[model samples]
Target: MRIPFIFIFCLLFSAGKAQEFAISNYDVLWNSQSKNSSESMPVGGGDIGLNVWVEDGDLLFYISRSGLFDENNTLLKVGRVRLRFPQNKLKEGFKQRLNLADGACHISGAQSGLQSDVRIWVDVHKAVIHIDIDHSKATNAQLFFEHWRFEDRATKKKENNQNSWKWAPQGDVKTYADEVGFENGSLYFYHQNKKQTVFDVVVKQQGLESIKDSLFNPLDGRIFGGFLYAKGFVNAGIEEGNYINTPFKAYELKTAKPSKRQQVLIALQTGQHLSPEKLKSETQKLALNSASSAKKDFKNNQRWWASFWNKSYIQIPKTADTTAYQVARNYNLYRYMLACNAYGDYPTKFNGGLFTFDPVFTDSTATFTPDFRNWGGGTHTAQNQRLVYWPMLKAGDADLMKPQFDFYQSILGNAEWRSKFYWGHNGASFTEQIENFGLPNPAEYGWKRPESYDKGMEYNAWLEYEWDTVLEFCQMILDARDYQNFDVKPYLPLIKSSLRFFDEHYQYLAKKRGSKALTADGKLVIYPGSAAETYKMTYNASSTVAALKTVLQNFLQLPNELLNADEKAQWQGMLTRIPEISYRDIDGKTTISPATVWERINNVETPQLYPVFPWKIFGLQKPGLDTAINTYKFDPDALRFRDSKGWKQDNIWAARLGLTDEAVKYTFAKLKNSERRFPAFWGPGFDWTPDHNWGGSGMIGLQEMLLQDVDDKILLFPAWPKDIDVRFKLHAPQQTVVEAEVKNGKANIINVWPESRRKDIIIK
Candidate 1:
């Protein structure tokens, strides 16, 4: 796996410039085998992911796909696979590498003059896994389909965190068994959910049982699994074994005769069906069809990967401060992880996103299955989840944003039902922590609540009245229309309903307080509100004010056909009722305030500077720039809470304010190599292993530093260091793309799409 000195020399000289490197230069290479699953590399495409590694002279991997939640709402792995060569061991001359440019894994080794090479890749457009092997001499092969959920297992205290019933189960919770066996000369496995699921439990807990029939139950009768087959392999029978802390039953397959070349295919299927026999028949058909078209599928997958890499990129050469170079390399690595779920039925989770390993590696003293992640699987924390999708716009991955938007659109009815049944209002009330079925997470909703408390509100301290986070996602939908010329007409209902929640619900609360629906000056009162889980019991929280004003303005600016006269007038009226962002004098300089007034501080979050980021109301070359900058420099709370950790945006705010030194210090620190063997496998920081929000926040900061589109003007190197040479291609608003590079302290604009936009480029 080590690059030869001659090859390195030729690469640099042939390219003619260090800044003009290809994506393959950043491919991960390892010369030794992994000790455990924690050291595995991620290889996946479309919605399928595999954690691949070579351990103890054998090849191993764990399979995972999107939307595989079980009855308890736990995100489950499909199963595990193990491959072994009887005559040749992989201990000598071993090499394992991830080829980022091709979206494939290549592993090769030699033992006592016998050599072997294996290639593993997933089809980008189909739910199929391919493994191709070649050997110097004929060798016997063994394939094992290992599954831990072969029998029902009880889940005790602390283990319930993986499911929806966190810390409050109705009774004994058990992970049911999966059906696994050899069928028609293939290893088949699947998990079918029972009729009773967490969706039913949450409905009754939230007093929405009357509307149970109207809800969308994603886990009801759900079936997920696949078949592993090879032309020359036969069933070797089942065996029991223990790996790590769990016991498993593995269905084995072996080669019928020694062969120099072999091909293995696995076809996965997931859907809701009542008859297991029917589902099995469909799965077999898919496997047979995939085998017939394997050659054409391989070519199409390669073409897809080639086009994906050509869309956009960022590359930097090694520098004196190695962290700067590491930052750029890790950026591409993390983006590849996000691309794994481009076509997922659900969005890539903010916690692990399809790349989690064993739990003991993330946290000790808590032994659980591979399905265990700290946060609940189906629950979506809007604050953390928004960070995961926001960077996709500037990276030119707008097509990848569809899954997230479609998630919200599918559940729009349930969200609006919450408003109508509880408050008789006319908008969607999406909470801070929501389930995939569009209800409050039962655990966060509190099993013990006072009889007089509002039925619609969560009784928890951190999440109550924190409904404004959904506006950030609504804004993203609109930004897609502006940035990529996306057809967002389908999402207008979701946007308008979310906007109406603030307008109608606040009026309802205002009437309950006294008389008039608005204040004397005619602005909606956003009282009893929380600001990003901080600044509790606030009045007119600055985050809410900024969100409402910005989203409403953007909503009104859409194309005429997308919004009729009545819809436009209704939103314009709501815009008039949005309060102005409040300000405070912190240590003599005026800075943005968390809220007009608040009762207590609950958590650590700098919502005061939210206007500087996400909202984009104040920043470089904009009004009140000094006030926003002063908030970062002088505000005691902002200073006390500054961090480059998970879901934190201080680096983004610094970039927007044009603070080059602070941007470099924090952005580089956030994007630097992780503690794990894989450089981009960052974090259990406030989340789980391979924490995606941590990588996402880092991506936003890096993109902001390189280029920014403000007021239809493209600014280059806005917060970037001048002397550090770098190359990047990023998207801009107005359907534009910018490609630029810097070498020896001078900047060059290589190409700008729609050449007429060249006049709008400004080199900072």
Candidate 2:
């Protein structure tokens, strides 16, 4: 592999000239000093720069970045969650402060009956924290978070935390013999397989023996008890979490480590142990065994990440904003965080994200949620969430992409189950809503207005058309993982159900265009459900058209080796009647969603791009390529829309349309806009923290615009604009990797790495 140019690391940033966090707004944002103490520095939320909120009573906190080192310290920062037993509610004999640091950031508020089963930890070099929280908590446990920046008294300036000394906190969580540990630099947190808890607590601090007591808040019942300047967060469950187990996961790629190879051995040894306290004798032996290589490993860790940043990165060449670099880095870093926090089994698709940080409501800025939120999955949200995975797919992050595929698989079943109910047969019918569990949730999660998705509207049944889009992604996961022992056949039932629904549902809409003719003889048009999402709408939506086309095409592409002849022909037949997309001229503007006229659109972009984005039905393929392009261009909002003068949906659709300039504009728009956050992670104008949806899309938009390959042809600057030049490389399916640089509306090839065995660039 060629060495890269930029540096990528787990950064700790602070607004007060200390290391802490990032947010969209770059201006002078302020947060409350924690009631716990005055010594804490405010940490900006990692990516979404979300507004902070301390809820119930999770006032205790200290925010510290994993893998960060203080400039002068040889040891890593090890922040602790030192909570003293409440004096008033305590026994007189002995009030002890529980203070051990090496456990993963877990939520175990000492509930007597509840086992501290959940443990959330950042995977090696990954920012994604794997969560193992209990779904049974009736009273949400309180969380304590703190962020501190070291100011060197001698330099008389805030100390940069990039070089912090790394060490495990001496907390009881680390005392478990089965507690996981890095050999030298790996980031995976493992517990003894036979351990009692699902997670281990990880303690981190900047390694200062003691900071001023002022840093902590004097014990108070309020969320802002800490005097230390820190951020806090609270999660309101998903839109449908009550139906399924509360699923939680974090996203991030491991930081290039100091001693990855060596850590493998150390980790293996750690896996062998059960508890540190019980095996103190063995612990000392292992520490001594690993001491000699510490220095060498640390240096290598920095260099590895530095090499990664050198390749495939976005640098703001020239921006008027003073915090341009911060914003630029924030966007990229958050993408890194997304990758780092991403999981292997489930990408946590719409189940929501891992490091969702915010500040205590009292403090205007910083915070982190110890527990995962309830269920929620949005139609408009899927693409943005999928964006984070685009780069990951090529970065050799196959495991990270699993959750995304699992989500699709789960939904396929959900669509099929709904279809079976609605169609009165073995097929798929999509409802407007779904949760982490693979089931339709109209019974709960109904819109307050209660229309389509919830069965009040006429066209809700057509929502299943969107499932075809999910099928295409399933194909991607199939290719990414080589499909090796993974049994996707089980999911084919859903695919069959979807095709069955579409083939039987579609009707000739060409005969009914507007007015009484729209209803024709008023036969109460049956079948083709609406594309869902809106209240009441028409049958056979452009979205359904795009999706039906996608589904038909996907079945045809499945290798003959993988499918039976009968199944293949059935899919081919469904491709024939693919519905026509409807468009109207609102002063010559062609838009794609359910309504063609192009209004303010309470919903975001048109579903027509289902073929363009998550679905790959129309590319430089068959013919609609130009039509698709025109439709995108004709709509004013296709690339840019002024929602109260603020831009939305532009960042995503631009990339889908291959409009690199538009994509970049939307990207920097979120960055440069005054109302936007300074750190530039991008959020809706309303809140400072990032909506993970948009944050994920930023990565996908940029990736799609830069490089695209269907089967054989790799298009350079396909939709890239003349103003911006991009340099990057991506890994394609079947082991082929593509790297290049584009400038002056042209691309220059850099490199391509092909896995020894892989196939199908663009299938015919």
Candidate 3:
């Protein structure tokens, strides 16, 4: 049958429109007062972020920047800003909407017989914040900088059992800000770390003082601050705190004239080896540069966001059941949050990620400052942290993944030095909970450890044998190499060193246990190991074995240019020494075992199904599928704790195993809107509210449900519901994109890049 070219073009255009995931007017709105900053809307670009909200008829936003670590190792906020206008103007008809496509927040309301509109956006190309205000009538306004941590306070360690206080000492923690002054109608505040940062303290405490010179200190000589400029406003002196005698500083500025339109700009700068005066001058120059190119920067910001949306999208057809819509909406919203910190020097933190509100809002009893969080600052838990980056593979967010890669590479030297100094090995020993300086987080290492405890092992039981999660991140790099075809040479060291640690560390342990450590079959025994904090003091942990085997295999597959013959041989040799995955019988069915032997279960995690996920050794169209499914069905921890929460793998494992009903059920629970105003602002489940790992794990599951790639084969609708209509564009290996649509239980392959790749499509 011959079809008209015009008809074909029109059909293609319609399909494209159907795939668009744009948010229309009033789709995301907040009309009433926000209870606290936790309910605030997130807005940012580049490395700057702001948690903006309207509280008690006043505009409030907490400003945060990446790489702004204080002396105490806390990722401190720049400061808070509060803007006040006429009270009557904000009394009625108030609404706030996040314009996803344009990457801006719009708040409008009618007050004092006048209508006002305020638009806020962060500059994509520069470290600046732009705010434009328009009103029907001339009005007066006040802008204030509310800083709570202005004075040096003695460290009063809380007795709470949280991880933040694990290694906290009783001493004065110097405030980051050295000065807060208002001059020439502009406000300036700066934070300069002391000569001694937490890096030095951690080194001395962990007995690494001998190798201190080799360590990489990211906080040393780092200075970060901002300049606030209001052209038509005059300085109104400073107030100390909200109360009469509170020790804090709040600088104020007031409008000098009545005007219907106003614009404010905040210019930020940060870097190592920078002086306070230099930072101040640089910020002033940035403010001027922002003013001169305001219009162009605004257009550029919009274009960046537009291109981001155009890269990929997942749009569900309007359904009578709102749950489906909420799931799709929350997925997009969480992705938006991840984009806010696109160029952070460090990865977007798994804890709050620059959107943390005041602590008292989450709990009244824990009345701490804004800087308080359950997890310590500058601490990255590899297991929970890997979740934050895995979804970027399918999302096709390659540019955003650079920060995370750079983080590991930047600390590679220090990590390698620590391993060599501790155990005389030639690999990087990155711990489960690591400091930014490439050592174990001080508190997680434990201050009251027994004299006989191994210095290399964390004092905590859960993190003792947790070194394999980094393999998943290495897999991400390999997957990226296939997707983007970029130079993997830079990341080769990270992959090799990560695997080297496991191989060499195990051999060191075998030596300690004598030749008997190797069973009669000659397979290395991994003892005193933990299966993801669940099975402690275990031997042959399934997750560890799978990680080593899978990563080594992938390591051997890298290009010859990236891997020398000797390196490849080393990886292949290690693979042979790794123990086979353990298995057991449950009710006459064979299933994967968590480990060969263990002392006791310390936590609730399903390491048995790990081979099904991050390792991908078992699942749909893979070997040992039945065993993986049986393990999922019978594993006690998997059955008991199969819920959508922090670090849970039930949804992901279910999807990979092609359990459609179970996958859909868990995915819905994982992606549905929480009680918070922001649909994607999820729980304090096992972490903090707006738990990033929870959202990240949910994203990974949702993407896996839609598409699962094994080598060259693509499995569509592997765990997706037939009743739900969906349109999506997801990336796969080999730089291929699978654009698909499912309508009325019929799957349609809209487009597959490099058409030859479509030959391997398996529509489930």
Candidate 4:
């Protein structure tokens, strides 16, 4: 049966209208003065990012680019640019707005009755940033490059606290930077890493010097450089650092004549093993090319952002309650931040994600360089890091997931070598807090460990026995495959190896215990396991158990051609040996247990809800939904630890369990206006300002509230509040999308891809 033409047209028209409405409704507006870098607005394209702010009556923006790791493994900023007009024209009447529809920042203000308007944006097709200024009257302007780390300095011990293996501090750490100078009326700077990197030092410190050659190194010979060009400006004298005596050099450019309009361009270039001359040449070419095609590139940049916004959106109706508006506004704001680093070489960092500002603003005692953050550089905590990327599937940002997937795959050899070298195992063993070179972070591993400590375990109590979070990432890849039908053949080895490590490692532990280490029920005895840093010395930890079971089951469901018969049989046999999820009775109500047995509690995490989220073993359409609900309601730890902060899963689990009131309460808390200038720039809570994981988890919770899927069945408004009206377009499995609107207790399905998938829709 063929569909009628008018009906099809109506469906398309409604979908377009919803997208247009979402784009027009949510844009950040600021009319107050920005006191510091923390109050800055963000703008970016490709792999470049800028935090544009007006500080002390001057326009200042910090330049940051993805994959610009220095020799010490710190992610460094490119430089800072300060633009000043005659008589400080940006002091009052300042209004800066982030136009989300075009990915640009517009700043306008009047000083002494002189109107000035500035537009800042990054070229989507080129490695350049353009700042266009137009004034009502001709005026002289000056642009300067402000750099703090101008000389080679020894890293102080206080700054080394965040690095891996802080106890075994090496001799004075030397920092390096690009040589900056003025040439042909332009300021040029560049930094190139040495042939050797911190990876070699870390490997030797961990007693792996003999096998260092076998490990992967991701930082050798990396180079980054850029040139700043401003039309009609001549080179001015440089100024040494005066603030805090942090030795810095300033390159000044003064306008040759008073002009109504002036433009500045900063072109950047980065890669591995590029010569200094080549970098300079390329940067110059980029600046010239961008200057010649500015108009065309601006239009293309706008189009790119428009397409990004069109991919997916969520909008709530106007309400007198400010919280409701903030929930919808912050959702879009956080998503925009994610899009800034969409093409990064590394996955967005959980701490600050390229938008980090001065450290003194965050902690009074912690006065350090702009590169400093809570967690060490090049170290990824799997638990916190996983939250940063989980929501991309629902947001229809599948392409943005590649950097993370590639990161794990890049380090596969090192992970496998470590496992085999230590325990003669055939699978890779990824640690909880992992380094880019594929091993436990040295500082977190603890240098002064006792002889009885396990070689593969982290010395920190919070990270010990926390090896299951990688499965969540594996699950992400599997889910992405289902949502987009993308090729997973490259990732199959990674998924299988991760599961294989758990099976082999547990069996190895059982053999060490005794000849009959297997339980009477013939299940693997997972001892000395920690349930998400909370339960110490536990057996059959529920989080790890659920991850193992869920991943293995999902793996088997894939096409047989993707997995050989022998591999299939091995996984099937291993699944049965895994322990059943444990449960307990709390006040006469059955609830999920953190683990079967544990010596003591350590952290504040609620691991019992693992079965409810990340693994859909007992939620919504799954069996034992009532039992999971009882656990959520009755569990003491779950109640005590519930909050919206760094890496918290309470809001997500509540929505997954179909608890409308609980979900709304937590979602509102998660999406509330952050103290920062940008509404979505949340937290230094357990992490850093503009916490990526905090925002990422909040995004997941909101998405779950609107739509959830179990196999082929899609449930709409599962945990959404009836009083709150919403329109959203979210992705589901089998290349399907669910666009729907809910108002006045009525749900309307706008469209579903492939048409045939609509048969499985279930309104909850």
Identify the leading candidate in terms of TM-score: 1
Off by over 4 Å in 1: 1-19
Instruction: Please name the candidate that would achieve the greatest lDDT relative to the true structure.
Output: 1
Cα RMSD, model 2: 18.2
lDDT of 4 by residue, 453-548 (tens): 777667887788778888998998888887756578889989988888887888888888788757898888888798988898899999989998
Candidate 4's clash total is 4
Candidate 1, 1-764: lDDT as tens digits:
13346433432343333336588878999999998989999999999989999998889999999999999989899989999998877878899889987799999998888899999999888898988899999888999999999999999889998888889898999999999889755877789998899899889999999988898888888999887877689989999998879899988899999999888888888888746676677767777788888889888887877667666788888763588789999999999999999999999999899999998998986699988988888888889999999999988788889889988998889999999999998999999888988899998999999999999999999989999988988999888877777778889899999999999999999999988999999999998888899899999999999999999999999878999889899899999999999999987899999999998888889999899889999988899999999999999989998989888889999999999999998889889999898888889888998899999999999999999888879999999998888888888887677788888889999877656789999998
* Colliding residue pairs in candidate 3: 89-111
TM-score of each: 0.97, 0.53, 0.94, 0.94
lDDT of 4: 0.82
The TM-score that candidate 1 achieves is: 0.97
Candidate 4 structure, TM-score to reference? 0.94
For model 3, the local distance difference test gives: 0.80
Q: Give candidate 1's whole-model lDDT.
A: 0.88
Q: Ten-residue segment with the worst summed lDDT in candidate 2?
A: 222-231
Q: lDDT of each model, Cα atoms only?
A: 0.88, 0.36, 0.80, 0.82
